[model samples]
Target: MTTLVKLDHVTRRFGDITALDDVSLEIDSGRIVGLLGPNGAGKTTLLSLVQGLRRASSGTVELFGGSPADARTRRHLGCTPQETALPPTLRVGEVIDFVGAHFDNAVPREELAAEFGISELLKRQTGALSGGQKRRLSVALAFVGRPRLVLLDEPTTGLDVDGRRALWAAVHRQQDAGATVVVTSHYLEEIEALAERVIVIGQGRVLVDDDLSAVLDQVGLRLLRLTTPTPDRVRALTGVVDSRPEHDGSFTFFVQDADVAVAELVRSGIQFSGLTVRGATLEEAFLTLIADSPKQNDAAGVSPRGI
Candidate 1:
């Protein structure tokens, strides 16, 4: 795949605070990459640099081999910011046409609207639309130009399950049509459903970057829930990362291999019941990654909050 965007040792600062710290990564064309992090993790700042909304304090940022700040470079980019303020009085079709005017080869207005499931509301005024409709329209506008690269920052902030799935389908179609997409979202399930690669950031720095399967394998986690009185012994078993007690005399153990842990429990005569083992969710894998990430110390040797 062709490299669409590149950042080398990039750092962004606001006043006395650093928002991104010595970050380096590349987005390849034709891939849907998921950016995962907690609140204030500098995910937004990173996207801003790529969108040319903010300048990097140090190092380099390249969009399609040109400076992101250049209009020529930005022309091939489409973005849906976290907050969207559309002209309320304009009809939905008019609003779509307004955004399409910026690109010389814009997608047909009606086709674009239909692709995003807004064809029925094209005649409705923007102000009269529901929250979900507004959100979908905000996202659909990003594809109006048929951009080569799309950056979506929490695109489904206020949508029901069906709405979210509809948006996801539109994104998949975009990728299938040869668009590279970078999605920054708090929803783990969204990432799991949309991304082929996952990048995790913490404390304003890159914590994990790999294929989705490899990221899950990096932690090799399995959630084991059971009833056991000897929590200490359960925790001491090999392959067990940690264990926590529940109110109903149950324990949830983070383990590498449920079979190994269970076998060990039986062989050692450790008392356990109500045993159940399940695969880790993307959220569980993400939490484990950030928890084990080393905090980057600042000039004063203090750990600062993620920007």
Candidate 2:
């Protein structure tokens, strides 16, 4: 697997504000990578730099072993921004056709439209389409050229559950066809399902870059739901981190060690109707990473409404 993209000590600034600070990362070909972060965390800035939409203030940005601005590199990269601007008067098919023409060898316009369920919408004017339809059309445009690398920013925005599932299928199809995908999404579950590797960003810096499973392991909190009659006794246990009793009399405990905690509960002579332990979810890991960072303090000054 060759390196498809690399950012070496890259930094981007806007006057006194630092959007990215000494960020370094490498993404390989044929892998789906998730670029995740809270608002103002530079996830979009990083993508913009990599796609050549903006220049880095310091260090280097490379795509396909060449500068991002290189024509050859551009041919292999496709970007779907969070907000896509479409010509109001143009029909959906016309927009895709126009974008596809930019590449030397584009995917068939009809095929791309059909893949995203936008075939029926091809004849409709871009402005007349619903938000979900517009989102689908934007995604279709990104796939028009069948580029080796695709960058999707908040791809699932404004999509309902069914629409999101449809988009996920299209993404999986791209991965199956050997394209490298970099997605930044607000939906943690979507990232967990689509990305093999996860990169978390905070304060314009990389917080964690590793296999999804490995990153989850670092945040080792588990939720244990038990149907014990002695909920009070379980709450009294010293090892239990936090315990809350449900209306149904069941107790759910947040614990650091499931095996040891359960053993202790059993030894306390409590009979449980059921005991289940669930590992930390990607959402839990994401929140933990952001909360633990010193940058969280800076977030306070950015207006409470925005934070």
Candidate 3:
């Protein structure tokens, strides 16, 4: 596979704050890779370096086998950041044209708009559209240049269910057309739906990088949710990785093995009810990684936000 983007021992800082630390990864061509992390986990900082919007503080960032800082190297790249501010006065078609004008042989506005399910809004001014519609337009603009590598940060932030699904379909189509996509989303289900490989970041460092199934399986955890009168004792149960009390007077336990954990709970004579055990979802695994990270920098004050 072709390596489209590479970061070697990269670190980025804002004043005294380190947003990304000693990061090294390669984004291969034609894969939908999900970048998963909590807020302020340095996801955006990494993407910014890839897009040449910011320079790495200590190491190298390469795009298309060249420096990301070079305009020529980024010609085949497209990015939709966490926040998009479209010109209110510009019509949807006008905005597409404006962004497309910078690239050679850009996709036609009509074609690009149709692919992203925004064809009907072409005549409307950006200010007049709904939040979902505006988000669709913003994402569509990224593909106007027919990029080979697309970086999408929180692409479906404001979209409804159907809208989000439609964008997922659009993303699949992009991948089918031989584009590499890097997506960062708070929605773990979104990553599960669209990504084959997952790279999880936490505390300004990579915590997990593996195939989707491997990442899930590696956690080897089960979620046990039950209403226990003695929540404090439930948290200290053997095999429990972490425990959280739900808003509705229930405790959720992340356990190494549900059966063993449940057996231990029952043997201990804890008064609990409404017990349900299931395999840990991506969200659970991601959270477990963050909580168990050797480098716990969350207490170090807020840094950059990825989405």
Candidate 4:
């Protein structure tokens, strides 16, 4: 596969606050990659570098084998930032037409609107649209150009459940149509839904980069929640990573093997009630990684910045 985006020894700083550090990464053509991180963890900074909204302080960033800032490179790219600025007085149809006019291969206005479930809002003035409507419109605009690479930064930020699901469907359709997409969102379920590959960043450095299943395996942990008379005994159970007493006298245990923990509980004759076991979520994995190593710089030989 051709490499659509490349960051080589890249770094970006904002007056000594390292937004991205010693980072090197590549995004190949036609992949759905999720970018996850906490606030100020450099997710926005990385997307900015890719979109050519900002220059990297050091290192190299390339899009389609050309500088990201090049007009030729940008012509094939589409981006929906966390916030969008739309012409208040413009009707939805007019706004679509304006952006669509920029690309030779733009998708037809009617078709794009239909696909995004915003066709009915075509006659409405952008200013009168609700927040969710505006969000859907902003995301739809990204695809108006029939872009080969799409960057969606918190694309569903203000969207309701139905709106978010519609956007996810649109993203899936884009990927199926052969666009390489990079998405950043605080919602882990969104990432889980749309991304095949996952890149987890923390404190401006990459903590994990792998296929979604592999990344989850690396964070292999189960949570066991139950009510026990002896909370301390649960903490001492084998394979238990940690235990926390809930407000209602229940205890939650982080365990490497839930089955083993349960067996131990049985052998100890512990009368645990309301036993529940669930797999760890992406959010849990992300938090664990951050908690384990909140602020570690990259290796000395690397540079920084990404998306």
Q: Which prediction has the highest lDDT against the true structure?
A: 3
TM-score of each: 0.87, 0.80, 0.91, 0.85
What is the alpha-carbon lDDT for the whole of candidate 4?
0.84
Task: Look at candidate 4 and give me any clashing residue pairs.
Answer: 10-304, 11-304, 22-303, 22-304, 23-303, 23-304
Tell how far residue 253 is off in model 1, in angstroms: 1.7
In candidate 4, what are the lDDT values of residues 268-299, reduced to their tens digit? 99778999999877766566576556243222
- For candidate 2, what is the lDDT? 0.81
On the 0 to 100 scale, the lDDT of residue 79 in model 4 is: 83
Candidate 1, residues 35-74, lDDT tens digits: the string is: 9987768999999999898999999999999999998898
Q: What is the Cα-based lDDT of residue 292 in candidate 4?
A: 57
Q: CA lDDT of each candidate?
A: 0.84, 0.81, 0.86, 0.84
Ranking by TM-score: 3, 1, 4, 2
Q: CA lDDT of 248 in candidate 3?
A: 88
Model 2: per-residue Cα lDDT over 65-89, one tens digit each: 8998776788988887343488889
Ranking by lDDT: 3, 4, 1, 2
Error of 4 at 236 (Å): 7.4
- Model 4: lDDT of residue 107: 91
